[model samples]
Target: MRRELICVVQHRLHDKRMGDEVMNIPRLGVGLQFNPSLMDWFPFLDQSLDALEILFDGMMAPLDGPGLMLPTMVQTMDEVVARFPLVGHSNYGGDFGFDELASTPAVRRHVPLARAFGVPWVSNHCFYSDDSWCDVWSSPLQFTQAEVDRLAVRARALQDAYGVPLAHENAAYYRTCPGSDMPEEDFLARLVEQAGTWLHLDLHNLYANAQNHGAAGYSITRFLDTIPLDRIACIHMAGGRWLDNQYHDLHDTPVVEPVWDLLDDVLSRAHPGAVILEYETESLHHHDGVLDIPRSIDAILADLERARSAWDKAYGPGNRQTTRAEAA
Candidate 1:
């Protein structure tokens, strides 16, 4: 009963025995989307932890060879395993919501990290943006199940090659919202039913859709009810901005009020097995001032904590744990 499946090219399959050990990601984890001023190609860097978004480029031959790849950037999953109290970069998702770099092999090839990073999930945004990706699609907001399926096919192929599942987040499209073959909810649900991979539920995107259109462009509750919950692997929460009467998904500041409400609704229904704060690294520190990162990170962390608390109330503490030892 599958519809569209996408995957990457097959390689020497990684041994499960070689799999990274499972670790519990705290409700609040740091985002690696920021580009640090300092970086060099080396191994076992003790200082690069400051750089955000764990730089992963083509240079790293043996992932665990003599040296670390982008030492000043990526904190090896093994190194960060027990060193840092915060969850590792496994929670990182390329917020290329509107930036499509399909033709760029390195950008498109990031999914293989499921093994390299020991992450339970690898994900990307379903919404297309930026002119750089127009070559792959007719338009950014080309909203149609057919269009989404085309995109999903590419993602499925990556999953196949890596022997790991991939999840696509429902994107908030204000610039190019297209009328779908069916309602957005049904369209998204059918996509998951057709693809065996999984879904990265973004309550923030859903909230944006409702706000831009009437509350019915997609029903927060109905969207939840329709999607095959079993296909969902994680939940994503983030904030945005509004200016000149337009709502933009900045993923920078704290989540808005409506999105927070939608998240509570999500916690009530199917509690996400794992939740992460999708934030922009640009918010890390403004060279011109005393950055307000403490507040921003705290907001994101608080929302994630709230999600966990609500989850405990609904599913009970016994059902919850950070490690994926049992699932894998």
Candidate 2:
């Protein structure tokens, strides 16, 4: 069963790689997060966008147990896959620091879907989730050596099960978990190195952490300098708002100025395979509490343009042809 599944995934994902090996993942360039609201604009986004990051949880339904993908959702996925290169994103299960017995089942459930989507790689948060704690969201793990070793085992197991690369994203938290002795960057570097996994760098999350934790300790410069930039395979850019003196990593607005500056800085140093813009369509702040769908779409396109420009500037204009060809 494992061999057959690996063969299926490799066959489906061959076009995106440089060779027959599944390990040779493609460089996807600039892309946007897939949202239902952007369905109407996809036909026109090819010039500005090079790929789409699909939230796999959105396509799932709780049929009997954990969840399954309905036929309609599969069809939607097919349609999108036919249009652009795809990268899978999920927050359910597969948490790096979660219980192995509990998270393994959920990871198994997602493997077939990842193969079906032909995603070269999939990404999830570096946090842990438990119903006993916050049922709706994940919580950051303590940055200790023991936690790093534990999560590395889980991450490696997940990567082997999926038969593809697994990239873990940094979490934005209000406060450091007790007993976290190491810095976030050091923990991440050690974790990825030990696990043989990739890093799905999220600049906005770093921005939020910097805001909440103060620049003297958790600035972007400190993060980029400490972590292994080459391990970053994918990048996420999002917008947030300051409410009650707290900067929330809310995906509900345009890419803020500071985040854009961070993106530029990261691009100049790290050569990530793709940079994706994440905007939540359902957020009230996203539409300014008004239903101006066209205007909102235009704003998204503008952000894509900015991302593409930055990517081209960093990697050179000639590579745009290669990006378009690969995304085709």
Candidate 3:
């Protein structure tokens, strides 16, 4: 029966007032995209969105009690999505990222897991940056357009087979491939059009990608232009962890400026779905060296607030009048 509910995702974008409903701004709400202990920290988050990283599968498999045993997450997400925020799937596996789980036995049985978890949709990183697996090339962008088409065909098949509404988030690439055929936006737009799905649209990643290449490469503004506003299912907001000279997308930090600019651009163009910052770098049950958890969370929450203000300026009170004035 729950699996039947998963079908709603297919029909959601078609609903008459989806645009208006999506644009309705809400007050402050904290959404968590990583870790369960966050529940203990932010009690009020019960009303916010909670997305689960597929790497969290390890916890879901081995059930037990409340402390931390990787309880059956599919069922858990169903229950949580019912109450506070629902659970959606992030990338499967560790920080490196992997998408093969759609074919794995455990994930296969959990297609209804999204519905069961009360999750309306599921999201994964769009680009191929799986550090754990050597089979796929190091850089997804490096591949030719034909190569991507070949891969998208298979990827979309997995999306359909999984039965959950699926979308891909762009990832931060350190450098551009010398011989890459298509631009990142082209690849992303094609993937969405072909799959008949939407995107998670990680604005921060777009900034990073643009900075690495050049203006000619992947500018955030150009990236936004490439994606049709109607097809953007949901959006993700995250802070990039500045390590060494490169930026790592760790959600623990407050959002930086460039990403904020991109978010403004996106909100001006598309609507927001569950916007949970990827803040999952806390201690795992006090076992992994618990540090200032609240402080870290506050940083992300503050960033979320800033983004809300930016959205307001673009589409909220002031923008509405501006549009009216221009039209009149």
Model 1 per-residue lDDT at 94:
25
**Minimal lDDT window, size 10, model 2:** 129-138
lDDT of 2 by residue, 240-310 (tens): 88889988987878887888998889889888879988877543255345336666667777888898889
Cα error, residue 297 of model 3, in Å, equals 3.5
Cα displacement (angstroms), candidate 2, residue 77, comes to 1.1
lDDT of 3: 0.52
TM-score of each: 0.64, 0.85, 0.67
**Candidate 3: where are CA atoms >4 Å away?**
1-30, 36-59, 62-79, 93-102, 105-110, 127-143, 176-179, 283-291, 310-328
Residues 1-328 of candidate 1: C-alpha lDDT, one tens digit per residue: 0111011101212333322232112232222232232122211133222112332332232423444244432433334433322211222222223334343332333444434444444555664443333332212334577755665555555555434455666777664455655666676676655555567777778777677755445567677788877666566667776657766666756656676676666666654445555665435322233235555445545655665565556656544443222334
Model 1 lDDT at residue 292: 58
The list of candidate 1 runs beyond 4 A from truth reads 1-71, 75-78, 83-108, 129-141, 177-179, 281-291, 297-301, 322-328
Over the full model, what C-alpha lDDT does candidate 2 score relative to the true structure? 0.74
For model 3, residues 1-328, the per-residue Cα lDDT tens digits are: 2453344434432442322233222222224455664555754333333333332344444222232223344454445433453435545422223445443423443344443443455666544544243433334445367656665665566556445556666767666666877777777788777766667777667666665566555566677787766665556666555468665655555566676677666666666554555555552112233447666555555665675466567656433222334457
Give candidate 3's error at residue 26 in angstroms: 14
Candidate lDDT (C-alpha), each: 0.48, 0.74, 0.52
Model 1 TM-score, 2 decimals:
0.64
